[model samples]
Target: MTNKDVYIAKMKMQLDELDGQMSVLEARAKEAKDDARAKYEEEMAKLHEQSKLAQGKLDSMKSATAEAWDATVAEMEKVRDAFVHSFSYFKSQL
Candidate 1:
């Protein structure tokens, strides 16, 4: 595969793994107290929005031209970083 292809594959895998971890967190959130569950749901909603943005970026990347690949990758990384940071903070609170 080309470098771009490899990078896309790696990112897709990472996103999948992150999604799985988020699922586990969702289950844990359900077991929390009412107040805590409310907070967890709010954070989860933000994460889900970020996840959707990242997925949209990935879809764009797949169709990107060679000239646009780098820009698309950069955008994807920013979204990924934000998602990861948010996830980490939420997990710590749990």
Candidate 2:
């Protein structure tokens, strides 16, 4: 497969893994006390927003032409990295 194809596949897999982690985090958040749960939910809301943005970027990147492919990859990586970093920090807090 081409590099773009490989990159797209990898990103999709990573996003799927993140989604799974989010599910686990959501379950943990549900088990928290009311006050803590509120905090977790707030973070989760931010995460969901970021996730949506990342997914939108990914979708667009998939259709990008060769000329735009590199730029699209860079943008997608930025969003994905932010999401991953946020998820890691939130998970550490729990």
Candidate 3:
């Protein structure tokens, strides 16, 4: 379909995958030992915050008009990329 449509679909898919990853990370954090658990919880908390930010961006993107779609996508991607990067690094730790 259109660029806006494609972008929106892609972003939604990415967000879904990111949500699943967050859950996986959450479970892993819960499984850690006492000392490591504290650190994991801190990291997970930061990740949760990032997830919220990304979700907000996604919501904005969904409601954005054609004229504003590009800008919204750019902003959404920034937050999505940060979440992906952080999740990748966090996964490596486990």
Candidate 4:
């Protein structure tokens, strides 16, 4: 398979894993104490926004022309990095 195909497959797996992480965050939030729950809800909102941004980047990558593939991958990587960092930071706070 082509490099782009491999990258897309890898990224799809990571994105799926990120979705699972978000679900775990939601469940933890539900179990949080009152004030902590509010905080978790607030931070989780931002995480969801980041996740949406990542998904958008992923969608763009999926349809990108071969000539534009590298640039799309670069942008996707930035989004993925931000999403991961934010998720880790927020999870640590819990």
How well is each residue in 1-94 modelled by candidate 1, as lDDT tens digits?
Answer: 9998899899899888889999999999999999899999999999889888888988889899999988989999999999999999999999
RMSD per prediction, one decimal?
Answer: 0.7, 0.7, 1.4, 1.1
The lDDT per prediction is: 0.92, 0.94, 0.86, 0.90
Candidate 3 per-residue lDDT over residues 18-80, each given as its tens digit: 888889888988998999999888888888898889888888887799798778878888899
Model 1 regions more than 4 Å off: none
lDDT of 2 by residue, 1-94 (tens): 9898899999999998998899999999999999999999999999999899988998998899999988999999999999999999999989
lDDT of 4 by residue, 1-94 (tens): 9887889889989988988988998998889899899989999999999988988888888789989988998899999999999999988887
Deviation in Å, model 4, residue 27 alpha carbon: 1.0
Q: Once model 3 is optimally superposed onto the true structure by TM-score, how far is the C-alpha of residue 85 displaced, in angstroms?
A: 0.7
lDDT of 1: 0.92
> Runs in model 3 with CA error above 4 Å?
none
Residue pairs with backbone atoms closer than 3 Å in model 1 (clashes): none
Residue 61 alpha-carbon offset, candidate 2, angstroms: 0.8
Q: Which ten contiguous residues of candidate 3 have the minimum total lDDT?
A: 2-11
